[model samples]
Target: MLTFKVLAALLDYPNAETVAAIPEMRAILKAEGVDAPVLLLERLERGDLLDCQAEWVDLFDRTRAGSLHLFEHVHGDSRDRGQAMVDLAGLYGRHGLTVQASELPDYLPAFLEFLSLLPEAEARNLLGEAVHVVEALAERVGRRNAEYGLLLAIVAGLAEGPAKPVRLATGDMDEDIDAAWAEAEVRFGAGAALSGC
Candidate 1:
């Protein structure tokens, strides 16, 4: 659904087009039964984008609190995380979905795109597997009153079952971002590869 695309776009770095996209996103969310936030559109309409973009970077790009990467929340930098990435990317490939080199299969946005390709029941079941991560992210981002939090909540709502949270270790506060960036890329079967953060 276009709502998945819109939600995915909301996680990306903001630009002029992002502000212009607000109405379409809000309308699509409404049509999809998501009670979209009006405050976000109001801020964008008032051209408070500088502040919004700054908050986006501070909340997501800088901190691990709302990382869009699913494995980062579930597995950290452990060896298991690498294996999970490979497995997930392979799952996408097996289903004939070609993930871009720049996007991780476990990335929530990419995952949402994959969900859009699945039948409703399958999509809901798959989403249920990661509902905890979405719920935790929603809670964290909602505390800051970020509109992006609503997207997470909407995703969590789509999945079946209780909103149980997955326990995770605190990430290394002193960890190097560039170093983390240099970690091995996730390689799917048949020579596909994606270098994602």
Candidate 2:
């Protein structure tokens, strides 16, 4: 009973050559025990794989659409990139995802993993703020949430890359848990505050 929607707006048919070259991707799906026809139809109808693939695509679309409207409000200038990141982070937060200080090292990588799956613009918009918030909170938490942090780090790393040259570090803090809580608060507030864009 995994009910989901495949919006026609995102549909795209794969060419034969492209499909032929994706045996590895297909094999992975098979290894995961997905029904081939269901997977194909789901991907075909949604323009991407299930799991994070479809979610990222949808988030990208929403971010892009929101950016367009935001530009109008600012006389055609781009909105604050940080705000876009906040918006994206808010989306993930709503799904019960957030980075913790103790788990910074591991979580950072996960965050980058998820970013890699996204379009450059979408990844930049969403993950850039997420890293900042995560790092900031990590400094306060003293220790990160090992499980959640690892999950986020893996997902983020998959989307983007390692946070090395980027130096996305969470600094020292008096209260690490508070920092993480604040990050979640920001995300929740943004989710509630954002209007039609």
Best by lDDT: 1
lDDT of 1 by residue, 148-185 (tens): 77767877888877756567544433245434544465
Query: lDDT for model 1, on a 0 to 1 scale?
Result: 0.75
Off by over 4 Å in 2: 1-144, 164-170, 174-197
What overall lDDT goes with each candidate model? 0.75, 0.35
| Per-candidate clashes, comma-separated | 0, 38
Position 4, candidate 1: lDDT: 65
TM-scores, each model vs. reference: 0.77, 0.25
Over 31-60, each residue of candidate 2 has an lDDT whose tens digit, in order, gives 644333344434434453344344433322
* Residue 57 lDDT, candidate 2, scale 0-100: 35
lDDT assessment of candidate 2: 0.35
